[model samples]
Target: METQIAGSIARMDGSTSQDAIFKDVLAYKEVLAHIMKTCVPEYKDCTIPQIIGYIEPNPQVGQVGLHPDETNPPKIQGMSTESTTTTEERVVYDVRFSAVAPGEDGKIGLIINIEAQSKYHPGYPLVKRAIYYCGRMLSAQYGSVFTQSHYGEIQKVYSIWICTRPPKERENTITSYTLQERHLVGHVTEPVRNYDLMNVTMICLGKPEGKHYGGLLRMLEVLFTGRYAAKEVIQILEDEYEFAHAHTMERTVSEMCNLSQGIFEEGMEKGMEKGIAQGIERGMEKGIAQGIEKGIAQGIERGMEKGIAQGIERGTNRERLQNIRSLMETTGWPAEQVMTAMKIPAADQPKYLKLLSLPQ
Candidate 1:
């Protein structure tokens, strides 16, 4: 019965890309709690409020508490729990948590970084990319741009990677890596040192089913596929009472179930006239993703399709710049690749390439 339900969700997600917005639901507490259960396992009992307070010493004031010198807000929002379909990094951190505060107001917590990667890069590998992100996180903690903070104030950073695609030489679907020291001289035990202050976890969605990760795979199904995995999501949550009560999963189901209303409203607001049908038709004719960019949203929002392109050709250069930026940010493609992929004009390519080199 549960398996049948999950199949329905997969089919639904196939049509609507709701799974692409896992970052939105992440703002909820229940979702964060279950994520913590999968990644750290240590804070399995920590509630939503505890997770918030632990991440920021003063959640009311929005203090990250990541560093003692960190009084002012960091430029990057310091805490981005959502996922954006942008051209930048796909770093989702419940997959990577850095701190954990234990029981009884013990104040044991971590400064965490979670990155979610839907696509795989064989050239760098997920592990290597994860290491780079973790290293950057570690270095960023050396001292704030403001006052100097001691290294002692640096909280443990956890870099967790959840990959929708499996990488080469993947040992297990879920593998945890910790620092270990070995002494071979006197046949003595290799002492596991405490000096290493960071940890990494890699979860591969394509891995074969094992003991514990089955539940995680199901959770991922919901996170990545939404309504397509709705049935299994319910079954999985039923098995875990806490997860069921959290309401994050339930909320996602509700949103997916109600999405038709939103689409209809959007079409109506866009006038749903000949333009609406034409825009949708163009989008389907091109590719839903590519069409969504130039078709309905842009077509309705701007009311010009070829005109936008002509403006570029005439060197007026407004929509062209906006489209390039939108594509770059949304797709995270290099300027050249984006150019080729989008079939940008040869003359326009040089201008676009130059734009990429300039700082955003």
Candidate 2:
């Protein structure tokens, strides 16, 4: 029990599933029975047997509340009244153990509560256990508060706990605490019934000084050794692993292949979208260039018609305008150059040409 409980798969809030808990419980039933039997010696009476019942619906293992004191208190020198109110509050468990025993009142007593622990709340487990035992004994006697008198019956309780770790740095593996009364001034001070406490036996499982914890030590060894020694207990504990290393590798490869395929498909989809966008932009640019060229051609044609009309008006109205076709023949210019130099009105070009020694 000196080693700490180690595991790669640690328990978290959401890690536990119903199936996991059920499977684990079934597999570790033997260990659970052993722990319970060792804790509660009364079960060895050959009457009551250890059982794994369903999880409690309403568990009050860590509950604490303020309650009124049922007894009187001590008086101070200047105090007027000799009474003071106090609180007595604790948690109660819901499970029970059935057994018959002789009570202090020389009557047959039936102990009800078996065992309970507050695993989460720091140091409240032992306190909660005591309160639960008390409550169970009280309930068995009166049946219910409405049916019988308060504190009538005499029942017994046995509370036990199994822990993986120790409480703080305490040395003793098992420690018990109980209520006690001390004499004060002159007359015995009114009994501080609220402080009428009980004992607690804390068994720190982490101590391995002796062989008294054979079962706990074995459990711890299995957890810490690292080497997988296939004992019956280890096999039961390993019921959680569903596959061997080879099968695990195969499953991992399969999942990776699926993920790779999905990534490839997604990348292709994004590429297609980008390509479509670029294609549309290129088509629009090409269409705009073609339109601009066509507009420029039409504008050039309109300008040519306007220039011809103006040239005809100038030749007919202005006397200074000369038919330069005779100057073009005298100069012997090339066809293109002649056309440029002989600036004649197109409407009067035929009459002007008849006047010159030009061919028909």
Candidate 3:
């Protein structure tokens, strides 16, 4: 009797925007219930239909105006095409079910609101759950009041929080906050309603005993823990849940597997692009060094050729000049220093300095 439930799974980064996760989660409403029942045994008495009843249409809570028809009570319109009301997404599901316990007056009952949560948010989700429950109950009974209680006195508001992350010893402890009596100074007792607190109950599904949760645990073990789970957990995957049996669980398993593969491929493509960029940088460095060396070699070769050509011409024309230089050398400068100071044709000096500067 299970069918597709609406709502997506959050992305790997836990982004709820990815409709992919929601679509798959919606596809297996039965699985969702199984997990819930396992984690909270109180759910065994709670039917899926009841859970759906506790659930409001909108996943988010805020002021929303329902269509004229939605505002009307549930009734079969006898299949009339002229029924002017239309359904829209603006109507959010604020709850799954409203559990009522009879109050002392019996005229009004205590409302225990049950809200299912899977994604992580920074604020106290349970507080939202409490406020929404109170708001919905107030609105259902009293449209608006500047400042007064209506629909009889609120007996108690219970907010149940189901979370995906396990409670941490340092921070994630199971906690409940409520208005209680405490001594003002001595033995005199005073009630604390700091901002009208309600009974808030938080259950962190990420606990180690989380795996011990029947349906929810089985689902999470396969989805999160993977290969590291114990033998009993592995057996649960092999037996009760279809996500474990890759062959039998086609739709759910296939969808999750494909999504994971796509995410992996996307990461690899980005990495490859980075690697290619590094390779190109290295290649450019090598090319620049080679170009510089080739230019220097070409310049030296041209200079040496010009110098040899000039020396040959000077040798033929130098008898008078050469004898004059020999007579002037009587200045007694060391022969090596005199030779160094001699103005050689600019062409011959170029190749000599070029050869000397090259590393041996």
Best by TM-score: 1
Clashes of each: 31, 4, 25
Across 135-210, the per-residue lDDT of candidate 1 in tens digits comes to: 6666655544213645555555677766665555542367777665665566655322234556788876643444
Report how far residue 28 has shifted in candidate 1, in Å: 3.3
Assess the local accuracy of residue 255 in candidate 3 as a C-alpha lDDT between 0 and 100. Answer: 48
Error of 1 at 127 (Å): 0.4
Assess every candidate by TM-score. 0.47, 0.31, 0.34
What's the lDDT of the predicted structure labeled candidate 3? 0.43
Give the per-residue lDDT digits (tens) of candidate 2, residues 44-116: 3321122222111122333322322101101001101111224443333323333343223453333323232
Deviation in Å, model 3, residue 347 alpha carbon: 43
Candidate 2: segments with Cα more than 4 A from true spot: 1-94, 101-129, 136-141, 144-147, 150-152, 168-172, 177-201, 207-212, 215-231, 234-360
Order of the predicted models by lDDT, top scorer first = 1, 3, 2
The numbered model that scores best in lDDT is 1
Ten residues in a row with the worst lDDT in model 1?
1-10
